[model samples]
Target: MIPIYFCHRELLGLLFKSQIVLTDPSEPPLKTVHKFMQKQLTSNVSKPLSSDVIIKSNTGIFFVETTEKLEPSPLAVCAVESASQTYPDRTIYFFMKGLTKNMTITKSSFYKAIPLLSSMENVNILPLDLEEVVQDTPLYPWYQKVNPAKEQYWKHVSSDGFRLAVIWKYGGIYMDTDIVSLKPVQEINFLAVQDYQIVNSAILGFQKHHQFLWDCMEDFVKNYRGGIWGHQGPGLVTRMIERHCGMTVFKGTEDIICRDFSILNTQRFYPVPYQTWERYFQVWNPKDSFNNSYALHLWNFMNKNNKRVIIGSNSVVENLFMKRCPRTYELIIKHASRK
Candidate 1:
């Protein structure tokens, strides 16, 4: 009786408060008291505070900078699809600057190849209009003035500017369409190193209205040299890091935490160097699983003329497609059969 009273104080209190006086030693049965205590416990803390619970949300954005809206290549399909799969919970957006028509996941060409991408309700396709992105962006006026003589030059320089502007306005992520995501990007603000000496602007993540992004936009205008290759792209990003973080050359590991922002090593994005871009699509060691890499950049520009992802080839790219984007792999296999 003593132990029961100590264990169930509320029950004892209720029994004591009752008007009925228990003169008999066998007044309250232990079993009856246990049942009453159970009822009291259930009554006290049953319902949960439904509204007080907080839900976590994150947004990621990717862009395709092309002039015409052709069917998305398998690699391009893999890039967006893998990103969507890796971060299923996060809001994933794909921006096509050249596309005039808006497309839903159901209507998109890549949807047939990767059904998982279509199921991702969080994924959105948006048109990348310079006028829309540049309006509120700090470097709009500067972007208007730069006019490259050649179309190819414009494609490179304009994309460099657009990436910065859109990211500044939206504040999520800006990944080049060639990047195939392997895992969830954890850092809110990060830049990936292309090599030990250079940082690539191909992948950038930031919170909305990050001041560092604003500074990068400003620097793009001040150091506008569209003719020279990489001057406005990787070179600009490296220069900005040097100015702010005091990093002359980004010598870091898979993850580097700086005072201003975090930096990921070259292996995270560019596991296969530009010089050895073909090796990525070739038969390599099956054991070499790029464990440290979060994503792999196919370096489309470098391999544009030579390297192609064959359907039957047991190459690294094909293997990646099988494991990461299986539906896409099946689609490619069917296409190969038809061919």
Candidate 2:
């Protein structure tokens, strides 16, 4: 859930550079909207904020910033956007925007302030910068020794090409060249990062709703010097993650390749592993496609066609991605006509 005041353009400015999180509804940080969130929480819920907003739930999209006190005020909430005000179906809430600034209050204060919106366990206000919201994210320390550089340029290039192709054709998250289908999904309106093994910091979830995905992207672009873990794009994020002392404590079961990224059931493209499907995982043998494994990475590529990666069904690969991307197909036909 997002706080109301953070939406104000100027206050919101305070947020982009500040850290935030997607909290479980159970441990909500604020009890009531600070006079800041109260006065600032605009009725103006705009079009789904940038997927970059990050924290997500089945209900709605928002970016939250919390304060300690709930100084009272009665500022009428402003409309977020024209589209939002016009749509009756969308119920985007901007809670607690009328409270005072920088005051330290607790979840209990919020109930006294609003006297509405039933509270739950995670009902306390969430802190935008959780200097103490610590968690243990895990990883394999073996990668610490590798020198970061442009090793597999062609494969990376090809993957980029494929990514753009899918984005131009398919309208959701592009599966990394390595990912395979896991389970059948209904329909996802937003683009989510693709990975069952690791966070694709590469493949992104794009939805008008999520601004956090883009936030991660922007943060990577700004900070990444192409470190060993984050070679170019995703590596930047992972590298930052690598620096944190708390990272090693969480679940390290996921690989860095493709983790938690959802596999859409649109049947857009049926991708296989970089090797024979049967020979995908080296250390582990996964059973389910989407759950256990959705991709097989052909990591550590060199200029060696002699070192063959049995992409099992080459003809099948050709047949699978046979249809021209609609936009590209139209362009090609138009270009040919001109020629």
Q: What is the lDDT of candidate 1?
A: 0.63
Where is model 2 more than 4 Å wrong at Cα?
A: 1-171, 182-198, 227-229, 239-278, 281-291, 298-339
At residue 38, give the lDDT of candidate 2. Answer: 28
> In candidate 2, how many Å is residue 204 off?
4.0
Query: Taking the tens digit of each residue's C-alpha lDDT, what string does model 2 give over 1-339?
Result: 323222222232123212223233344334332222322233323322332232223322121222233431111111111112222233222323233333333433433222222121112122232211111111112123223254334234323222322222223343332222232223343222223322233333334323333333344334434323335444443433444221322232332222223323211222332234333222232332333322222231221332222122333211111221122223222333455
- Alpha carbon lDDT of residue 223, candidate 2? 47
Model 1, residue 102: what's the lDDT? Answer: 19
The per-residue C-alpha lDDT of model 2 at residue 288 equals 24
The C-alpha lDDT values of all candidates are 0.63, 0.28
Candidate 2 vs. true structure, TM-score: 0.29
At residue 121, give the lDDT of candidate 1. 55
